[model samples]
Target: MDGIFDMLILGAGPAGISAALTAHARGRSALVLSSDPMNTPLARAPRIDNYPGLPGMSGRELLAAMGESLEEQGISRVTGRATAVAPFGGTFMVSAEQDVYRARTLILAVGAQQGAKPFPGEAELLGRGVSYCATCDGMLYRGKRVAVLGLGAAGEKDAAFLERVGCQVLYLGPTQAKKCEIKGTDRVTGLVADGEEYPVEGVFILRDTVAASVLLPGLAMEGGHITVGADMAASVPGVFAAGDCTGRPYQIARAVGQGNIAALAADAYMRKEQEKQK
Candidate 1:
C-alpha cells in the first residue's frame, strides 16, 4: 500500500483532465495514466466549435491548453497502456507496461474507442489460455508455444518478455490483418490470423486496454458502454466512469461535465471511506 495514490485517472482528454483537476482541487493526490497517441479521436479532430470559451480551437490546441492547466495544477501524467485493473484490499491495482500502480479510488475517463473485437473464444478462454498481461501470466505459458497479438507497443514489450520466459512466441504486429480468431474447445490450442492457422497453446491479446468489464470482472456494462449512475458512479464501488466510455452524445462538453461529476462523486466516496476509518 505504500506509494498508493488517492486517485488514479486513466485518460488525458477533457474528461480525464477535468477529473484530475477536480480531485486535485479537493486535496487528493492524483495521477493520469494514458497510452501514447492519447485521446486520438479528439486529437485528430480538425476543429471543435461547440466547446465554450475555446471556440474554433482544434483538438490539438485544446489539448495543449489542458496540458498547461495540468502542469499548473501539479498533476503528474504517465504514459502506459493499462492492460489490467483489479480490486485488492479495498484499493485498486492497475497493471500496465509491466509495472503496477495502486490507488485508493479510480476515475475511468478512458474513451470508448477500444480497438478491435476480441478473437472468437478469446473472452471465454481468458485465464484458461488467453491473457492480456504477459508479466502476470507469461510464466504460466513459459516453455510453451504462445501467440502475441501486438495491438500497441506494450504488446511488443510483452512479447519479448514471453520470449525471455522461454516461450516459443509468435509475434504479430498491429499492421497484420485484423482477422484473428482464437481456436480451442476448452482452452486455446491455436489461433487463426488472416485465415491462416497457428498451432499455439495460448494467445495474448495485448492492447492499450482491456474492456472495463474485462478489467474489473464485475463492471456492469450496457451496449458496450460502462453503466454509470447520475453521479457517474459505475456499478463497481470506488470507481467512477465518464467520457465516451459512458455512452451517447460523445461531445466534449458532455464528457467534461460528466468528468467533473465523476470526480466529485469520487471525492465524496473517498471522504466517506476516510471518515469510516477515523
Candidate 2:
C-alpha cells in the first residue's frame, strides 16, 4: 500500500479515534494503526459514569458506539502493531510488522505503555545489545545469536523473522521472568532466565506495547508518560500525544478532550510546515 497520510495515529482507543475524526473533519487524510481492540481496558469495565451523554453505559457499549462512529465516518484503520516511528525528510515513517507508512504529522495516542517492566541491565544495555523491536533491529544481529522474550503473537512473528534472517533465535515464550538479567560487560553477551544462562549477542524484548521513548528516539517523557503541553503537542516537533499515554486523570472524557486538542495541534503544525515549504 503506497499510502501517505496527513496524520498517522497510533492506537485505536477513544483518543486515537477521536484524533482521526477531528483530523478528517478538518479535511486532512488520517490513518490509524491499532493492535489492541478499541479500548480493551475500558471495554472490560462493567460501567462508566463520568463520560457525559454516554452516562451509565457499559464500557463495552461505549466502545461499540465509538467503533460504529468511526465506521460511519469511513476512517481507515490498520490492524497491526507499530514497531517503530522515525523521522524522515521532515515527515515521519511508521513501521509495522508487514508494512511501512508515511505521514506528515503523527499522533501518539496509543493508550499507556503496558507490560514493560524492566529487566536487569535492560535499561543500561538499551541500543547497545538490548532492543524492543525485532523487526526494526533484527537485521543488526544477522547471523548472530539472539534471545527473544516475546509476549504474544507479535513476539512469535518477530522470532520467526529473526530465524528466517539466519539469526540463531532462542525464543522464550509468552511467560516472561520478572527478573531476567541481560549479562554483558560492554554490550549484550547473554541472558539469564530462570536461573539459567544462554550465551547470545543481543536480546530482543518484544511486547504488545513499548515505551514512547523506544518508539521514537528522543521523544521526551516524564515518568513513563509522553510529555505534552496544554495543546497536547509533545516534546518532539510535529508529534502530539493523548489518552493514557500522556498521563493520568485516566478518564474517557479526558482522553477524548485531549485527543481533540492533539488533532487540532497536529493540523496547525502541518499548516506551518506547508507554509515553510511554500
Candidate 3:
C-alpha cells in the first residue's frame, strides 16, 4: 500500500524483527513483511530454553517480544505472505498477496523452509499458466477453467476472486493441496486432484510462505538454504539473508545475530551505492 522503503525485511520472526530494529537504528527506513505468526513454525515451537537473557520462554512469548520491539521502534509492517519478487531498475519489487512493495535493499528472513517442495511440474509451469498470486495474474485466466491449490483460507479467497473475474474455479482445500500434482507440458494443462484429473488453464498456489527460491529467482542457496557471505549478503547484490533461511544452527540467538549483520550490511551497501553515484 505504501510506496518505497530503504529496506524490506521479509519476515517478522527473530531475524526479521532484529533486522528491522537494526536498520531503523542506523537511520534507514525499513518495512517488515510477514504472514500471520500463529501460522508459522516459530509460533509452534514448544519451548525456547537457550535464548541468552530470555531463557525458557515459550515460542509465542519470544515472537511477541520481537513484535513489541519492532512496534516500539516505529518500524512499519505488513502482515501477508510475499508470493514473488522481481528485481527492477536496481530496486526489488515484492508482491505480497494484493499489495506490491518496492525497496532499495531486500532482506530474506523467512524462517526455515516453507510449504512442501514445489509440486511436480510447478516450477516449469510457473508464469506459463501456474502462478502464486491470484490478484496479480487472475485476469490472464479470464473465462478459462483454473485450479486453486492452497493451504489456508487465502486459497479460498483467491478462488472466489477468480470466479468473479470470469474464470471457472476449482477450489481445492489444504488437505487436497498436499496430495495434488500439477499436470502440464508447455503450460498448465490441469491438476490431478486425489487421483482424479481436472483440466484447467491456470493454477494459483496460496500458501502462508512461498519457497525462498520462488520468491527471488536464482537466489544462491546451499543445502536448501540461502547462501550468504560473512556480511550476510546474499548472492543477489541488493539482497541479504539471515536466520534459518540462510542455514543451520536454527537458534533465536543465531537468527538475531545474523539479522543484525544483514541490516548493517544492507545499510553499508546502500551508502556505498550512493557514493558511486556521487
Candidate 4:
C-alpha cells in the first residue's frame, strides 16, 4: 500500500487495458482505474464487426477477452471512475470515489469520453483554471500555485504537470472536500496534513471529468471531433488523447490502433523521464 506505481492507466476499455498490459510487460508497476461496466460505451456497443484478428465478435465478448488478459497478466484492476489528477511531492496522485491511487507516469486510455455531471460552475471553469489535461496546465503554474481537486493517476499526473510548471500544487478529492488531502474555505489553501496555507490562483475540479463525453466538450471540439496536433498528442503534454474520443473515425479498429500509438507515446515520455532521473 505504501508503494508507488510506474504507470496508472485510465479506463479499462481496449485502450486502457492495452496500456496496462504494455506498461506491465516493460517491467513497470501499473494499475488500471475504471468506472463500472455499465458506464462505458462498450457496454452499449452490442455488436462489433471491425476489429482485426477477430472478424466478428460482440463488444461484450471482446471486453471479456481483454478482462481475461488483464487477469492472466496479474494487473490490478481498480473499478472506479478517475475524477482528478494532481501532483503531490515528486509523485502523481489520482482520485476516485474514496480511494487514492499514485503513480510516477500515466496513460489516458479513455475512449469516446463524456462528462456525466451537469452542475453549476462545472462548465465555466473547465480548462480556465479547472482543467482536464495536466500536461497543458502544468506549465501555466510556473513558479506559482494551483489546486487540483481530484484523485488517482489522473489527479496525480495533473498535479505533477503543475509541479513540472513550477506550480506548488495542492490536491483535493475526486470524491468530496472533506475526504481530500487538502481542504480549506471554499478553496484549497494548502496541504491539510502540512497545515500551511499556500496562495492559490486556480482550482481544477476532477469531479465531472471521467467519460470521453465530458472530456470531449473542453477539448478543441467541432461538433463532436477533437482537433489534434502533429504528434497526435493533444494541446496538453503527458496527455496524448486518441481513440473514438478524438471524434474522428469511430471504429473499433481505429480506436484500438490509436490506443496503441498513444500508449507508445506515453511510454516514451515516461522512459525519457526515467532517463533524466538516471
- Local distance difference test, per candidate? 0.86, 0.85, 0.88, 0.63
lDDT per residue for candidate 4 within 1-278, as digits (tens), equals 46788777777888777767777777778888877644466767777776778656778878889889989999999887665667666566877655788876556666655433333444444445555556545666577677776643456666666777677777765554433233344543433323444456566655323543343334455454455554446544555555666665666666666666766676787788779889
Give candidate 2's total backbone clashes.
0
Q: Candidate 4: TM-score?
A: 0.61
TM-score for each prediction? 0.86, 0.84, 0.90, 0.61
lDDT of 2: 0.85
**Position 158, candidate 3: lDDT:** 82
Looking at candidate 4, the ten consecutive residues that score lowest on lDDT are: 187-196
Tens-digit per-residue lDDT, 233-253, candidate 1: 999899999999999888999
Model 4: CA > 4 A from native: 115-120, 123-232
| Cα-based lDDT at residue 8, candidate 2 | 97
Ranking, lDDT, top scorer first: 3, 1, 2, 4
Best by TM-score: 3
Cα deviation of 220 in candidate 4 (Å)? 7.1
| TM-score comparison, 1 vs 3, better candidate | 3
Residues 1-278 of candidate 2: C-alpha lDDT, one tens digit per residue? 34679999998888988999999899999998887664367778898887889778998888779877888999888787776788998889998865889998999988767665567787778879998777778899999999999865577888999999889999998775555899997999999998999999999987777668878878888888899999999988999999999899788888898889999999999898889989
**Which candidate model has the greater lDDT, 2 or 3?**
3
By TM-score, the better pick of 1 and 2 is: 1
